[model samples]
Target: MSRLERTMNRYRSLRCSGIADELQELVAHAEANAVSYLDFAEQLAEREQQVRERKRLAGNRKRAQLPPGKQLEDFDYRHQTTITKRQVHALLDFGFIDNRQNLVFIGPPGVGKTHLAVGIADKALDAGYKVLFRNALELVEELELAEMKGELKKKIAQLTRFDLLVIDELGYLPMSRQARYTLFQLVHAFYEYRSLILTTNKDFTDWGEFFHHDNVAVPIIDRVIHHSSIYMLGGESYRLREKTTAG
Candidate 1:
């Protein structure tokens, strides 16, 4: 075998497949440019690091289950007058997550609550933080099932592993007593330990009615709102307006 082929085999054996894959092209470029030995080595290291970073982010995005195309830049600041571009841009730094603070977006349906929440979550994923997105009812149901299976603690532990948990469309439907209790336990476990981003259609006053139990709702609200940034989005439903205009 040629010397180049032998060197590539050595790289692969050392688990530097990223460098190995680009070795031929890299060697050619280095020789063509008369690049120093140190510079050539640095280039190889950079290629391997970039490849690993891309793979890591791809895996995290898959595990996050973020809705596609919900980036912050795609959000329409014009339609949702309540929140400005500036306010949302400030969150890009992600001090809230670092401080273990929550972000709660409250508004009527289709007013872009989910968009903003998911947008922030997408940014968090790009910043290398582990994130998980779930519809409120779906998350509660999973917890309820886990409770029945006596795996509630294990399930909550799994969820808490994520740096940020995004719960979308909360209070769209009333929860059952068992479901409410299960959800409360999960939220309580996250208290002061991890961060949460919640998009809800119900107000704080209506939470008691939505949960069907004031006793359960109170503590959950207490934990969620403490050390949280609350944004109230108010406007007509974007979906309805678009349908009307289309017609």
Candidate 2:
């Protein structure tokens, strides 16, 4: 008998996890000239390979780290009357495209802005693009830290490395003069070089207020909007629907 057969016999006597019983039955069959150790070993190896494949896929699923409550399949394209389903599908496809153009999703709060943004970002990841998602406020904080440590340039370079940088909220906070300057510098660096997805409640005309003044805002807006596809999303608050339904 081979080492595998010896091990199986020992395990059979110990009766571990019922594999022993199963092995015993197989061994009895083998002894009766019915089963072969090579076949059993091949089956065991195949099962192990399947287990490893499952673990690999699980890790990929988790690392993708998509939005908590949104998925491509879950998007209600049927109710989105203004935008055709074909256009929405095209937008999703754009996320995977390699031209590296900018995309903007403008809409009011709770209108699935983040949902579509995240959904696209998830697609980008699958297409082998590196993506970074953060709110404008959080990005400001990171810039602040970088400035304090005298590593602002390095941090800006890091941000530029991502294939897609998603800024979740725009115009939510009135940025200070310094933050405004830093944001402009960041935008200027990526001018026509990388893709960005910006979600904002305010339209282009009102984006100046986000800088707390017009002077700094106009240039950034001009640079961002120059070569971008803009999508105006209009819909009732999806969150409100959940609340009403729950009530």
Candidate 3:
């Protein structure tokens, strides 16, 4: 009912949580330091902005679905010398998302395909891009179920909304006919609308074997490769190397 209580209540109602938290402490500091009115206002605004920025980054990270601890800096680039340092550095610029281009990483398992995909997508996430990451098999399974449930179109629409889509571990299993069809539809829809990243363990020549349906696989490859850069990686498994050293 008092003046100060009424003022604090108004700040809470306006959702100025950072200002509410720091008001009393900052006011004391301002008085002690003989701060001007403009300086005090700037401090209050800065505090609120910092709080909002932190929340934005956390939300972006969650939306990106990047596996934990897979940053480019943490990746052992020296081991995967096949990928040029300049090429790896260029990806973090996140320009491909703006240009609506795609990237493909083709290599054997344990050569850091997934790590590179996640790391590059992480940079986009930090820049406030909406990203979705899913294992290739998981995406195919979901699409298959959607088709069976007569929700294929709607599911593809939902996926196309993201700024970037990272599908990891392609060609690791034989895709079903329905899933292949669904995936083709997705690529066609995303063409020139959003960027995408695909990491596969098989060569382009062998991609048709995984789809098991030439008509479907070839189109997927054509659409994906039409506006994409492919990175080839070759090296011993970093995991195996680390284990050998630790032993």
Candidate 4:
């Protein structure tokens, strides 16, 4: 084989798939442009870097399981007046994840709580952080199953692996003793170490009712909010607005 073909094979073997795949096209572009050797090398390196970044983000998105097409840009701040555009833009910077902080979005149903959470989560995903989006019931059920299977530790370890975890629709269902304890344990596992974004329809005062009592609720709320930034959203329901406009 030719020397260039051999080099391409070497790049492939080195796991530089980007360079290997774009080798010929880049070389042709360099030749057509009559670029200097230094410029050609820079272009090649830049292309490989871009490809690697794209792959990294693609893998992050796949692992995150973020909702498709739910992005910060699409969030209707005009309708979600409580969640200000300024605050949302600030979150897009994703410094909270770096600081290992928590974000809580509390509001009634359909007030764009999950949308904002998902939007922040999308930004987190883009910012090179591992993210997971699961509803409160789903998370509780997983914890319950883990306890039943005697795999609670392992599950907690896995859950804590993500840089950010977005738990949506919290308090929509009442928690049993096991579920409440499990939820507490899960939060405790990640507390002060990783970031979490929670969206719930219930207020902090109503958490006792949602968790079924005050005694078990104190530690859970304390740990989560002790280091959290709470944004109490108040506004008309976005879903209703959409439906009304469509009608």
Candidate 5:
């Protein structure tokens, strides 16, 4: 084999495939520019690093499961006047995640609660923080199933691995006893360790009714609100508005 082919094979074997793939282009550029040996090596390292960073971010985004097309720019502050552009933009700094705080959005359906939560989550993913998004009912059901399988603790551990957890559509439906208990366990696991972004339809007073028991709901609410920023998104439903306009 040629020396260049042998060198490319070596790079691939060392898991420097990014450098290996660009080897020909990089060599041509180096010869054209009469670049020093040190400069060429630095260029190769930079290319590899960039490629790896892109791959890592892509993987994190996939694992986050953020809803497609929900970004900060897509959020309509015009319809939902309760929250301002400045307030939402401030979250991009990611201090809340760094401080291990939570964000709670409370409002009726279709007021862009999920959109806001998802927008912030997408930003978090872009900022290199691990994030996971799930519907509240679905997450509770999953926890319940994990409990049934005697893997609740394991599941909780896996969940707590993310830097931020986005639980959408809380209080849209009532939770069963087992579901409430498991949900509490999962929330408790995340308390003070990682941040959470929650979108709920129910207010604080109505949480007891939503959970089916005041006793079980209180502790969960306490943990969720502690060190959290609560945003009340009030206005008519965006979906309803659109439907009416279409009609």
Candidate 6:
């Protein structure tokens, strides 16, 4: 490469800042004196600005990933036959929304509980909180797998870093004694410090049936509700609508 071009290539790679305008002056002087270097400095400054702009966009994108979807706005609270507007507002006002208390939504199958929980979680994420959504059965299985690999504790630590955790379908699967204990450990560690959004089709009275031990179920309920919001739901199955329409 020519001297001027070679110098410019090296300068661009260095990405030096605050040298562009100075390079213009130098280029002008160099042109008059038949010497080169100023143009190379200007090219480096331009490259630096380009790199910084790209980094800024990448950072914004990473932050945007925290909020998964816009389903919150379409939750259709008006269509939910069980929860009243007042109750919904109260939940938003509860310590759960402001102070990050855990929230448990208990109801029979087909209630709009998961929709409401996801709605609230979306709002939290929009407020710049980190969130993770998983089914209780899936998370329990994953935790068990991690335990077999001797990494359960590390996995729990990673889970705690999220500001909001949404665990749906808590009673879908019968948890073994070990699964119950591992889940208890996860919930206990997150107690009071982070927000947990749980949607369960089983009532608290039946929790022992899933856990398979009264001792574990009782204390888990006690700790979970100690500083939590309970939304007891009652309604027909939302799935019924589709069935009726199809008929």
Which of candidates 1 and 2 reaches a greater lDDT?
1
TM-score for all models, in order of appearance? 0.93, 0.72, 0.88, 0.90, 0.98, 0.71
Q: How are the candidates ranked when ordered by lDDT, highest leading? A: 1, 5, 4, 3, 2, 6
At residue 202, give the lDDT of candidate 2. 90
Q: What is the lDDT of residue 191 in candidate 3?
A: 86
Point out where model 3 deviates above 4 Å: 29-43, 243-247
lDDT of 1 at 161: 97
lDDT (tens digit, per residue) of candidate 5 on 79-192? 999999999998899999999999999999989999999999998888999999999878988898899999999999999999999999989888888888998898899899
Between prediction 3 and prediction 5, the one with superior lDDT is 5
lDDT, candidate 1, 212-235, per-residue tens: 865899999999999999999999
Colliding residue pairs in candidate 3:
none
Which pairs of residues clash in candidate 2, taking residues 3 or more apart in a chain or in different chains? none
lDDT of each: 0.93, 0.75, 0.87, 0.89, 0.93, 0.73
**Candidate 1: residue 58 Cα off by (Å):** 1.2
The list of candidate 5 runs beyond 4 A from truth reads none
Q: Give the local distance difference test score of model 6.
A: 0.73
Which residue pairs in candidate 4 have backbone atoms (N, alpha carbon, C) closer than 3 angstroms, thus clashing?
none
Superposed Cα deviation of residue 169, candidate 2 (Å): 1.1
Q: Write down the RMSD of candidate 6 (Cα, Å).
A: 7.7
- By TM-score, how accurate is candidate 1? 0.93
Query: lDDT score of model 5?
Result: 0.93
